[model samples]
Target: MNSEEVIALAEQGILTILLVAGPLLAIALGIGLIVSILQATTQIQEQTLAFIPKIVAVLLGIVVLAPWMINHMVQFATEIFANLTKFVG
Candidate 1:
């Protein structure tokens, strides 16, 4: 592919990644921040306190968002496959 085509593909790939990951990342960040604040206030300082909640939140988020994430990925994959010939030649 030419440079312009490569750049376009790269941009699309990044946007797709961000779209898929944005929600989970945001949820994790929020959970982590809240846990940190609570720990600071209570002086617990337990490592697992922060880590476990974020992990649980991420897992729950994944479970809840699985369908949307799958749909987005499938759509992107389908588009790429449909455009394969153009990309190759």
Candidate 2:
């Protein structure tokens, strides 16, 4: 493919990755921030305290967002595959 086509594909790939991962990452970050604030206020610096909440939040986020994530990925894949002949030539 030409440079423009390659760039477009790369941009789409990156956007897809961001769309799929953004929610879980945001959930983890928000949980971590809240935990850190709580730790600072209460002086409870348990190593697992920060981690467990973030893990749980991310897992829950994934569970809740799975369908949307899958839809986005499938759409991206479908677009790429549909244009396969154009790319091949």
Candidate 3:
């Protein structure tokens, strides 16, 4: 396809990726921030202390958000596939 079409497709793909990943990343970030604050207060320098909560939060986020994420990804994929002819030709 033309450069404009290719760029549009790339933009859509990026937006889809961000939409799918944003929540989980936010969860991890929030958990990490909290853990950091707790560790600072407690004077605990254990790396696992920081790592475990972020992992758990991200997992829980995934579990909770899976359906929504899947729906968005499916919609994006469907749109891309449906427009494949236009992209290719």
Give the candidate number with the greatest TM-score: 3
Model 3, span 1-89: residue lDDT tens: 88998899899999999999999999999999999999999999998888888888899999999999999999999998999889788
C-alpha lDDT values of all predictions:
0.94, 0.94, 0.92
**Candidate 3, clashing residue pairs?**
none
Sort every candidate by lDDT, greatest first. Answer: 1, 2, 3
Could you give candidate 2's per-residue lDDT for residues 1-83 as a string of tens digits? 89999999999999999999999999999999999999999999897889889998999998999999999999999999999
Top model number, lDDT: 1
Instruction: Identify the runs in model 2 with alpha carbons over 4 angstroms from their true place.
Output: none
RMSD of 3: 0.7
In candidate 1, stretches whose alpha carbon ends up further than 4 angstroms from where it belongs are: none
Candidate 1 local lDDT, 1-89, one digit each (tens): 79998899889999999999999999999999999999899999888878888999999999999999999999999989999998999
Top-down TM-score ranking: 3, 2, 1
lDDT of 2 at 78: 98
For each predicted model, how many residue pairs clash, with residues at least 3 apart or on different chains? 0, 0, 0
TM-score of 3: 0.96
Greater lDDT among 1 and 2 belongs to 1
Model 2 Cα shift for residue 62 (angstroms): 0.7
Q: What is the lDDT of residue 86 in candidate 2?
A: 96
